[model samples]
Target chain A: MIILIHGLMLIIIGIWAMLTRKNLIRIIIGFAIVDTGINLVLVAIGYIKGKTAPIINDAVSTAQGAAAGMQAVDKVVDPVPSALVLTAIVIGLAVTALMLAYAIRMHKTGRSLNIDDFEEQKW
Target chain B: MIETILTIVLAIISLMAAVYAVLTKKTLNAIIASGIISLLASIMFLLVSAPDVAMTEAAIGSGLTTVVFLYALKHIKDRRSTHDD
Candidate 1:
C-alpha cells in the first residue's frame, strides 16, 4: 500500500541523513527517523485491507460471546506486527538515549559537536 | 474517499517534516522538526487502525523523545557556556 512505500521512503531519507550529517546529534536524530520508518513498515505490512484493528470489542464480538474469538479472527488485522512495533519503539528509545549519552561524553572530551573535530577515531 | 485524502496529506506532511529535520541547520529546529515527524507518524498509525501503536508513538516518540533531546541540548549548551566563562 501507499503507507508501505512511504515507510520505505522514510527509511531511505533517514539513511541519507545518517550518512551525510556531520553533527553527532543529527546522526542520532537520523537513527530515530530510521527507527520510526521501520516500525511503520512493519505495521503497514501486517495491515489487512478492509479489516479493523485486532481488538475484541463489542464491534468485533457480537451477542454470541462464545463465538467472539472466531468472529474476530476474520474481522481484525494481524496483531503480531503491532505488538512487535510496540517493543521496537521502546528499544528505539533506549538506543537513542544511549547514543545521546555517548554524544554527551564525546562532546565533553572533545569540546566540539562536529564530527570532523575528533580525529582520535579516524583511520 | 475522505480517508484516502487524509492519508495522502499526512504522508506528504510527514515526508516534508523529515526532510526539514535532516536538512535544517539549527539543532533546535531539527529537534523540533523530528518531533513533528513523530507526531505525524502517530496520526498515520491511527489512520492505519493501530491505535495502540499510535498511542505509544505519541507518548514516547513525540513526548518523551522530544523532552530527552531538549534536555540533552540544554545540557550541552549549559556546559559550553560554563566552559566559556
Candidate 2:
C-alpha cells in the first residue's frame, strides 16, 4: 500500500520536472523517472501481502507434485502484472533511446539544448 | 520489521534523489541522481518480492540508461566544441 503511494508521488515529481525544465536532457530524465514510477506502481499492484512470487518452486509444494500447479495459484501473487511490467521496462528503454536520439538531432539542427530556443517548432 | 524499515528508507532516499535531480543545475549531477533513483527503485522492487523486475531495473534502468545519457551528453559536448571551432 505504501509502495503504491510512493510510486504515485514519483510520477508526480517526474511530471513536475518535465513541465518546468528548460533543458531537453532534463526533460528526458523526467520521462525516465516517470517510467520507473509506472513500473513500480504496476509491480506494487500485483503484490499480495504474505504471498510469495508466482514461480512454482519447491516452496509452493514439495511432495504433492501432481497437485502443485493447482495449489500454487493461491500461494503466489499475480504474475500478469509482473509480465506487463517487464514489457513496460523494455518499451521504456526503447522510448528513452528514441527520445535521446531526437534530442541529439534537434541539438544539431537547432544548435541549442534549451527548450525556449526551439521557437521555430512552437505555435 | 526489517523489510519495512528498509522500504521506508529506500523510498525516502529515492524521493530525495528525484528532487535533487530536477533541482540541480549540472546536467551530469542530474543524470547521476536519476541513476540513484533507478538503483533504489530496483531495491524497492525486491522488497515487493519482484526479483526479476529488480534485476532488470538495476541492469537496464540504472546501468544502460545512465550510460546512454552520458554518451548522449558527450556527443552533445563534442559537437558543440567542433561547431565553435
Candidate 3:
C-alpha cells in the first residue's frame, strides 16, 4: 500500500515538472524529477516481502542440509534493478552536467536567460 | 485504502506546484519551484525503496543543478526591463 502511494506521487511530480516550468534549467530539473520517479517505480516493482540479499555460500548448504540453503538463495531480492539503478545514476549525472554546461554557453552567447530571447534560432 | 488516499494527496500537491511553477512570471521563482518538484519526487523515490536513486536525485538533481542554474542566472540578464511596456 505504501509502495503504491509512493509510486503515484513520483509520477505526479515528474509529469508536473515536465509540463509547466519555462526556464531551460527549470525544464531540466523537471526531467530529473521524472527520472527519479521512474527509478522509484522500477525499484518498487522489484521489492519482495521478507526477502534476503541474494548470496551463495557452499558452507550454508552443508549446515542447512541442502534444502534450506537453496531456499535462502531463492528468497533474495532481485539484483537486476540494483544494477540498472547504478547505471542510471551515472547517466543522470552526465546528462545534468552537460545540460548545465549548455545553459552556461547559452548565457554567454545570448546575454539573456529567457527562452523567448533565443528566438534568433527560430528564423 | 490509506495508500490510495495518500497517493491522491501527493498527486494534488505535485500538480499544484507544477501549475504554480508554470504560471509564475519570474524565471528565478520558476526555478525554485521546479527544485521543490524534484525534492518531492526524490522523497517519493526513497519511499518506494529506491534509495540509490533518491540519493542521486537529492544530490545532483536538487543540489548541483540548482547551483548551476543560479550561476547561469547570475551571468544572464532578465528579459524584463524597467522602462519597457
Model 3: which docking level applies? acceptable
Local distance difference test, candidate 2: 0.92
Q: What fraction of the true Cα-Cα contacts (under 8 Å, chains A to B) does candidate 3 also have?
A: 0.25
- Candidates by lDDT, descending order: 2, 1, 3
Clash pairs (backbone) in predicted model 3: none
The lDDT for every candidate, in the order shown, is 0.91, 0.92, 0.63
Q: Which of the CAPRI classes, incorrect, acceptable, medium or high, describes model 2? A: high
Q: Mind giving the per-residue lDDT tens digits that candidate 2 earns over A19-99?
A: 999999999999999999999999999999989988788998765766998889888888888888987888898899899
Clashes of 1: 0
lDDT of candidate 3 over A14-35, digit per residue (tens)? 5765575557766666675556
DockQ of 3: 0.25
Where's the lowest-lDDT run of ten residues in candidate 2 chain A?
A61-70
**Every candidate's chain B TM-score:** 0.94, 0.95, 0.78
User: Cα lDDT for residue A93, model 2?
Assistant: 87
lDDT of 3 at A88: 82
